[model samples]
Target: MDAIALLELCNYQIVFPQAQTCCGQPPYNSGEASPAKDVAWHTIQVFSDKKLPVIVPSASCAAMIKHHYPTLFDTGSTEHKQAIELSSRTYELIEFLEPILPYNKQSDSSHTHISLHRSCSALREMEVAEPWLSILRKLDGVEVSLPTLEQECCGFGGTFAIKSPEISAAMTADKCEHLLSPNPQSILSGDCGCLLNISGHIKHSGDKRPCTHIARFIAQRFGIQHD
Candidate 1:
C-alpha cells in the first residue's frame, strides 16, 4: 500500500495484484517447512499466471520466491511448476526501475551524494548494485557510492536473529559500524529485510541517517514528474 502510494506520488504507474504474502521468508527460513510450503504454494498460484514481470520492493523475498522455491517443493507438484514460472518472471524493484525509469539527461550532471548498501542476500543472490548505482548516477541531482561491508549477514537472518537476539544485535552493530563511515548519505538504499535491519540499527545506535527503498527513492528522484 505504501509502495503504491509512493509510486503514484512519484508518477510511476503501479500495477500490483491484490493478493500476496509477507514474502513467506520469516517462516520458510525457520524449520517450519510445512507452513512455508503452504505459503510458497500460495505464492506460486498467485503469481504463476503473471505475464508482466514480477516487481518486488524486497529483494530477499524475490530471491526466495524465485531461487528457493523449486527446492522446497516436489518436481511434479503444481507449486514446483508455478515456482519455476514465477522465478523466471521475478525481478528486484531496483533492477526493474533502473532500466525502465526515464533518466534526466540534463539532471545527470547535477550534484547530490548518497551511499548504496548492497544487502547481503540481494548482493549474493540478485546482484542488484550496478544497475541501481547507474540509475542513481543518471539523476542530475545525485551521486551514488558503493559501501564496504565486513560480511553479508547483518545478523537478521529471519528467525535466526529471533532465536538469538545477542547474535543479531552483534551483527547489526557490525553492519552499522561498516556503514557509518564519514560520508554524506542523502540516503542509504538497500533491497529489503537488510534495509529494515540496517535502518533499525541506525536508529538504535542514535544516528540520524536516512534510508530508502531503492525503488521508492528512484521513483521519487526520476520517475515521471507531474505538475
Candidate 2:
C-alpha cells in the first residue's frame, strides 16, 4: 500500500499483478534450486508483459530476481532467457523513484533527525547505497545519519536468524546500538526483515526509537496517510 502511494506521489502509473508471488530467494538461498526455479518461473510468467517496468518494494526481492534468477538455468536455455529478460526490467522502488521524484523545497519540521538501515542485499547485491542516500539527502531539514557499521547485517538473513538465535541476537544488538547512538527519532530501511529484526530488539530493550519502512516514511513525508 505504501509503495503504491509513493509511486502515485511520483506521478507514475503503477501496476500490480494479482498473480505475482515470492521472488524465490528463500529457497534459492537455502540450496533448494528445484523449488526455487519453480517459483522463479511462475514469477517470470506473471510479469512477462515487457511494456511495464517491474518495481519491487523490497530490495532483497529485487536482487533475487535481477541477480540470482539467471543462475537457476543453463545459459541460452528458454528459462535462462526469460530470467535475463525479467532481470532487465526489475528495479528496487527507490531506484525507480530516484529518477522521477524531485527534491521537495518545503522542509518537514516534524522530523529533524533520522537514520537509514541499508539491507545487506541492497548494499552488496543491488549497489543502491549511494542512490538511497542521494534520495534521502534531497529531503529538506531531514538529517540522514548512517550507522558506523552500516554495511553489517541486521542478523535477519531470512531463516538464518531462526536457525542461529544466539548469533542473530548478538548481531542485532550491535546494529541497534549503532542505530540508537545517533539519537535519531526513527530508523528507516528498505527491507522488512531488517526492520523486523532491529525493531524487535529495540522493543525488547525498551528503546523509544521507531523503525519504519522507507516507502511508509516517504508516504508520511508527503502527507499521504496509509494504514
| Best candidate, TM-score | 2
* Tens-place lDDT digits, model 1, residues 1-227: 44554345445666656797676777778777888888888877777666667777777887887888887888988767778888898887767666655464333344657767777666678887677677677677676666566345777777777899898999878767766664756446656667777888888778787877766565455442433
Error of 1 at 85 (Å): 1.2
Candidate 2: the clashing residue pairs are: none
Model 1 weakest 10-residue run by lDDT: 101-110
TM-score for each of the candidates: 0.84, 0.95
Model 2, residue 211: what's the lDDT? 94
Cα lDDT tens digits for candidate 2, 127-227 = 88777888778776679999998878999999899889999999999999998889999998988888989999999998877899887877767777434
Task: Give the alpha-carbon lDDT of every model.
Answer: 0.70, 0.86
Clashing pairs in 1: 107-140, 108-140
Alpha carbon lDDT at 103, candidate 2: 55
Cα misplacement distance, residue 58 of candidate 1 (Å): 0.9
